[model samples]
Target: MAFYTDTIDFTARPAFSNAIRGFFTRIIAAQNRSIDVERMQDLSDAELAQMGLTRDGIVRHVYRDIYYV
Candidate 1:
């Protein structure tokens, strides 16, 4: 019996796929916060106060996504 397959995978990718995975990871991370950050930053002081969020809290808000799981 003689059989073969060509299933290129992460191991065969650039930087052995570490770079690719990392690039997508960063993109997802940015996506997770971009909307919230942009909307919050657009709000005035009173609006942010009503939301109980501050510019300083933006970092924590993003960090919550990374840590929650």
Candidate 2:
């Protein structure tokens, strides 16, 4: 008996998507700074957890729709 391994690789198909491009470039770069001052000003524990983020961790994991994405 012989055992074989299967490998899967993906090649990204280029698309003219502004959102996809901006998310990686603009959003990632912008997240290096403080989170929106007014947005997280008054957040509940549930809301923060739903977003998988804490007040302190917002700017760090600051990608919009990060959980879903």
> Model-by-model lDDT, in order?
0.75, 0.62
Name the weakest run of 10 consecutive residues (lDDT summed) in model 2.
7-16
Q: Each model's TM-score?
A: 0.48, 0.33
Tens digit of per-residue lDDT, candidate 1, span 1-69: 998889756655667588889989999878968877777778898887787877778657656757652
Model 1 earns a TM-score of 0.48
Candidate 2 residues lying further than 4 Å off, grouped into runs, are 1-35, 63-69
How much is the lDDT of residue 29 in candidate 2?
A: 60
Model number with the top TM-score: 1
What value does the lDDT take at residue 45 in candidate 1? 81
lDDT accuracy of residue 51 in candidate 2: 78
User: How far is 58's C-alpha from truth in model 2 (Å)?
Assistant: 1.2
Clashes of each: 0, 0
